[model samples]
Target: MARNAEALDLVELLPRYGLENYKPNIEINLFGRLYSAPIAIAPMGMPGMVWPGGEEIFAKASHKARIPFTLSTAAGATIERITELAPDTTWFQLYRMPHNNLEMNFDLVKRAKSTGVHVLILTLDVPARTKRPRELRNQLTIPYKPGLHTLIDVLPHPGWMLALARHGHNSFANYKKYTNKKLSGYELAKFARQRSGGTFSWKEVSQFRDAWPGPLVVKGILHPNDAEKAVSVGVDGVVVSNHGGRQLEGAPATVDVLPAVVNAIGKEATILFDSGIRSGLDVVRVMALGAKAALSGRPFMYGLGALGVQGADHVVNYYTEEISAAMRQIGVHNIQECNNIVIRHENALKF
Candidate 1:
């Protein structure tokens, strides 16, 4: 029953708790993927539109921060390009395609491995496409449809338009060879919707588990039963997410579900969390609740889109500093110490 307003309330409380006096380290491990900090950049699509060379900039920033960066299947750059740019820091996230294209998608996964991607995350919750009104009003579709409205919207932002002209329109570059046609905006969205696996099921999850050789993580999980089922199917980890509250509006905040999901999986599986995590204190709160690590999607994108590479780096550094400060205030030194902290319920109604 977590509301969007509550998420915003927590976001507003972040800056008050600073990291100046805290001497802390925030390293974490996920299926042998060592991170300097438990913070990771969530996979986001169309980064280039937000900032010129968005994926490359973010990847470099992540490398500098010593954290893992995941590349989206629908990102502007190919997985190979992103892996090449970030090397040891890149992971790949898949938006599952229809059953007929499973082999092609598996080939894409193998290609990703060739580029040294160590982890494969399967995003399973986006069965239906969301209609973002702003995007529609701007006529900003996936492979971008350039209508009078779209051109007018672009005319005002000379910087963005200039970048687009220099780099060409932002499209899913990786899928070009497979699709053999150019798409943008609404066409791209329609194409993806036509090709995406709307009927993706648990059986396919099991199939992916057996087929992929690397550590497999199931993202977009919000239910404890789903977490248990993922463990039963041999998933290496489960990311407790509601797709950043973009998919389902009424879904519980990922923080509220972290404890139950961790408890359900026990010590056999890793429990990661995302959604509504805007600052260091929020990261500590989820860690205290039992998350092995935490990630942020829109925050880093905001930094990148608004300030480019430096902005991306600043966001990562800011969170790392924030988490360290929060830990020291609570008398903890490392992520494991977070477990000793407790949540104080506003009212106690149960035994």
Candidate 2:
């Protein structure tokens, strides 16, 4: 989280004054589709843990706002449901399932293709799960045991409790059907743990590229060589991310490496971005640095946590307005022009 915040804080945009006559355009195109803004809701696991039906709320809002909503494999809503909600804007993110002899992984790919998901993002960052200090401190767990401490935590947030009462517990909505038996909470989490782990090898990614007929992306890329490797393996694009700085404490901030990745393969493959994006100005920063579009997860989650159903749309609108104003302030009239804006980054990673 600190690294992501630094991505925003360490950069300064130098604005030109006389270019204020025209309105800035934030619209962007990704893999042949047009969006109203150069922004997307990054896929997040178990967003319902933040708000009941959080994934659904994001999908609906993304659709209404004409931006993409990438749904995580660990999302609380099913691929079919989120695709139905967004259709034109739905993108599916995948985590390789090494258990069940990889049947579950292929099955997920097949299901996404059948549902007409526009893009398939295979996340490559989580080679292994790492312990999170914040979740540990908060006593938060997958199944959420209600001990006295947890109850004390719950009492202060009556709205959260009320939402939980109405929505029940969040589950791996996609994995439930594959379990072949009714499962909830602990059982479902155990099932997912057994059936899922690890990132994909290049060979595995090539196989997926052959199987899925639409655009394919490999997320969690930080190295220029890895970005070139993803393009070589037939992925349509690469998401330059460090798993939002949630993994590998010593890993470089995504912004620091983004320029190098873009320099290496920006022409051959589409370059998307994630991590540390707290506002639309951050979106402009990455776009100016070379990302084709920016994806954010936490800020919208904050929106949902604070405002409920209205939060998702509010977050989108917030980014939209901020993006426009920031572009104008930087003297850019559109997203492409953002790339040419003058920027100062002392610690940017070089190839």
Candidate 3:
């Protein structure tokens, strides 16, 4: 995750001369619908940990901003709750379970549809859960069994503890349909490793296509060839991501691979970028390369943590403000113009 942050600093934006007269229109189109900006809140699990009502806060903000709000299946908020928060502009990120839980997976998909979510973002990167001893050592994994050490660690931050309590204690609400009992701490972590089961499959594309009636986006793609494969499988979009560098230790930075995937897939699929985006400038940087849109996660979490429900809307507005400022500096109007901007700085020069 630190590397993901470091990679963004290396990407310097080159300013274009003399096009500053025309106001940069930040509007964007995704899967035939128009949005106010080229930014969308990326799907993230357990956001409530960062803020009391993180999921619904983001949903409301995204809805007000007229941008897409993606809900992770593992997000503590259920599909029903997320849609209720942002019925019209909701998207869902799905994690397909292994062979035994295939039916359960479809049932979850059904639940997502019931919420009127239009886009199904199938995350292909989480092949399996990687072992992160830090989370286990702190007892911060699912079910979040707070030991004496955890109590000691969290006692200083009463706000976080209270928010965690109010948000219902890290239970995976979407997964509740499968089993009433909640899995937490080590047991939850163990289940993650066991549930990952296998990698992406071409055969599964047909299954998803047959089941979903909306635009299907395959996320977590880093390689050009995989981008080609995703388009060949008939996905409407491909998100260039590396799971925020949380899953793979030595994977390529998303910024490094965005161009390759976009170049390879071309119009076959809409190329979206994720994993390292931190601001409106970062969003502009990726768009100037080739991505049609950028999805961000951490920045909004930062907002939620700082200002509660209002912070969510504040962040969206803040990103929009930043995007407009960045575009004015770069001299572009609208998202399409950013699609093929010239890279003025070869090695991310400091401006």
Candidate 4:
């Protein structure tokens, strides 16, 4: 599914380099809060596994960039800790719990608000706990046990061990109190399987919207009908995504369905895009198609994995520069005008 999204392309036009007496404005007005850029760091679980202090690095860089850094309930740093690190620049991604644990989930939302999270992203995908063969094979579980396979895998990487020593365990700090003790890979997996609020109907989604009075965003949407439904229920935004192709392998590419979703919802709600954004041009493409902003998880993750904390800074600035350059070349002054330069290529071919 990730490959499918990557396979899609946006048509480019001849450079109109001389037409710019203006600067590119990439500012985003997310829920009345102004941000310097329209791109954000997508929440990835165990970002630190890619590099030590992964969440911290992202937090600092995001703060510097004046963009929201989404903290995953399953990854990055805890809400409380991230607030201390970056204050109001963080957004929380919520994975709804079952009705049996409704109060606790509500409390979790309150806790996030208490920590100064103004934006709440409710992900409505992953209907069931599907098997991920790669993770299973590698035994990448909660509290990451040093099984034979993993032990052997990390044996040669003295740097990872050193970083781990400095940063300590990478368990879900927010969920630590809920569980009795540190859970092993299998134990944690079992718990998640049992507790995962895999899929949600309209009623559940509406309930969440009513509860979260702040900027409420529903991520992981593909269908135009779903986008319309989100707006009808007073959602602040809809993120066109397929959980980065992790939820369903055969699902349509997010970019392919973006136009329909935008047409359905119109400007009724902010439309964000993700799932297979690899370059600054991709950001331009999504915006041209009709997205308020675009996020790339793996590209940023890869940056962190390749260059420690510095890689994160590079990712932000690199993307920013790329967007500005593309805007100039395509003769668009700002993100709002990017769509004007897009040549309709329904049968678009990738370069």
Candidate 5:
């Protein structure tokens, strides 16, 4: 019965099954670099808090899966450390700093390039650190204050506590050498606000394009006109995102806006989509609309929080298998074939 149920679910979810049959290939080329799959891991900040050495684990999984893994600016591990773990698979995502620290941020990009990162993803959405009420409730702020509440919370989770102990003081290790400010929970928030881009504009993006030699991808674009502007400013790609809806409450799903963004950019710029992508069918749906690739943030983080590195591996494999099955059922051989597939929505009034 379970097998029957699973089969029915697949058939119902994927109706692009019969018009024409072809295999789906997920390979993608970005600025002369080839990737084995059109899927890339979106940058998740402070993965270490969720799992012991989470960044390295994800990097290894990406290398094994032959997909790109982006390291967040606020990642627990330094850029150099992540690159060392997955030399060929690393991409760097930068959160542009304040104007006063702009040169320092640019220097950081050069440093990332020096460490062998090929792709530089510039995150332009964070005007200020949006309140994450959950973090506040859990007392999971930066520079982790080991308060009685936090200690009590972790007491039941001995394994995670032990791993945290072994990992040792895990504050953004990358920035410690530069600033003497030790970032604790609220302090981390304050520090981020201090350094983050509040006035970042397209002019800054153009400057970054001229400064950085590698492929530049601007993330956090949700509008078609913004995508067009990005291309005009000489960006190589635009990641269609609403910052996983963490930044705003009522932003449209990345899937819904993907087609317009792709059309606006035309074929000259690469269009990647993210936000609320929970399954393989979601990936297929967005790609069909016009995304060159699809990336997810929270799903992988859930896997990491649940099973550490092994959890990360399981999540990637789950997506790969799901995508493969979707291709076979849809009768598409590769990504290109899948791109030509379409879906029709029928009215629900039935006798």
Candidate 6:
């Protein structure tokens, strides 16, 4: 994760002289609709760990901002509830359930279609959970065991405690109906992981494309060949990511391989980007390299952790202002003009 962030920081946006007279229009068309900007809140599982009702908070904020909000299948909020909150702006990300002949997984897809999610994102990155050294070192386990050490760690944040008290504990609300008994935290995590058999095949993606009525996107693509394969499978878009550098330690940064992926399949399919997008400037950097839009996860999480519900809107506004300012600085009047802007990528991969 740190490597991803560091790699993005190395990309320098070269400023252009003059061209600041016209006010830049940062709007973009995504999922066949116009949005306020090219920024969207990327899907994150267990966001409630940062703030209670985190998914709902982002959904409301994105709706207000006129941008997209993607909900993870393992999110603490349910599909119906989030779609209700942001009917026009909501997107759904799904994980493959290889259990029971994929009955439950197909059910989730059906539910997303019925609920009217604008886009269906099939996440293909997590072949299996990788070792998180920080979590392992901290000995952090879900369904957090109640003890003095845990209490000591949590007691400093009274706001979080009060939020928990009011909203209750977070769980995989989307998958809750599948089990006979109530499960939250670790047990729910285990159940979902077991069902999420991982690394979807192109054939499976094609199956999902046929089943979903709306636009379909395949996330976790890093290689140009994989991007080509995803386009061939009839996906409407592809998210170029390395699972935020969490799944594979040696994987190249998404920015480094973005140009290659775009060259391989940009004409045939929309290429969205994820992993290590920290600012509106970072959004512009990817746009220059040929991403249709930039989906960010960690920056919004940081906002929520600091400011709770207000943080979502705060981040959205910040990105809006920054993207506009950056565009003007780079001599662009709109998102399309960004394609012509000059960028100095010191760390781009040579492939």
Best by lDDT: 2
Per-structure clash totals for the candidates: 9, 0, 3, 0, 12, 0
Per-residue lDDT for 74-107 in model 1, tens only?
Answer: 8878887888778988988888778565876777
Q: Judged by TM-score, which candidate is best?
A: 2
* Model 5, C-alpha of 99: deviation from truth (Å): 5.0
Q: Between 1 and 5, whose TM-score is larger?
A: 1
Candidate number that wins on lDDT, 3 or 6: 6
Q: Considering lDDT, which of the candidate structures 2 and 5 is the better prediction for this target?
A: 2
Clashing pairs in 6: none
lDDT of 4 by residue, 60-153 (tens): 8888888888888776467888878778688888887674646656777888877788789888886776677777877875545666887787
Cα lDDT of model 5 overall?
A: 0.75
- For model 1, state the Cα shift of residue 291 in Å: 0.6
Model 5: worst 10 consecutive residues (lDDT sum)? 1-10
lDDT for each residue of candidate 5 in 108-188, tens digit (9 for 90 to 100)? 788888999988999877776778787788877654666899668778888787887787535455555456565454565
| 1-351: candidate 6 lDDT, tens digit per residue | 777778778877777786538989999999789999999899898888789989999999988999999999889999999999999999999988878777788899999989989999999998887888887766665544567776887799999889878887666888887985656566877787677647788888998888988999999998899998898889989999987887888888889989889999989888999999988888999999999899999899999999998999999999999999888888888899888877778777765
After superposition, candidate 2 runs with Cα above 4 Å error: none
Candidate 1, residue 318: Cα displacement in angstroms equals 0.9
Residue-level lDDT tens digits of model 3 in 196-313: 4455587787588778888989889888888888888788998888888878888867787776776788668888888878889888988888888889888888888888778889
lDDT of 4: 0.78
TM-scores, each model vs. reference: 0.88, 0.97, 0.90, 0.91, 0.87, 0.95
lDDT, residue 42, model 5: 96
Please report, as a residue range, the 10-residue window in candidate 3 with the lowest summed lDDT. Answer: 342-351
lDDT, residue 37, model 3: 93
Candidate 3, residue 26: the lDDT equals 94
User: What residue runs in model 3 are displaced by over 4 Å at the alpha carbon?
Assistant: 20-22, 99-101, 161-167, 181-197, 344-351
Tell me the deviation in Å of residue 132 in model 4.
2.1
- What ordering of candidates by lDDT runs from best to worst? 2, 6, 3, 4, 1, 5
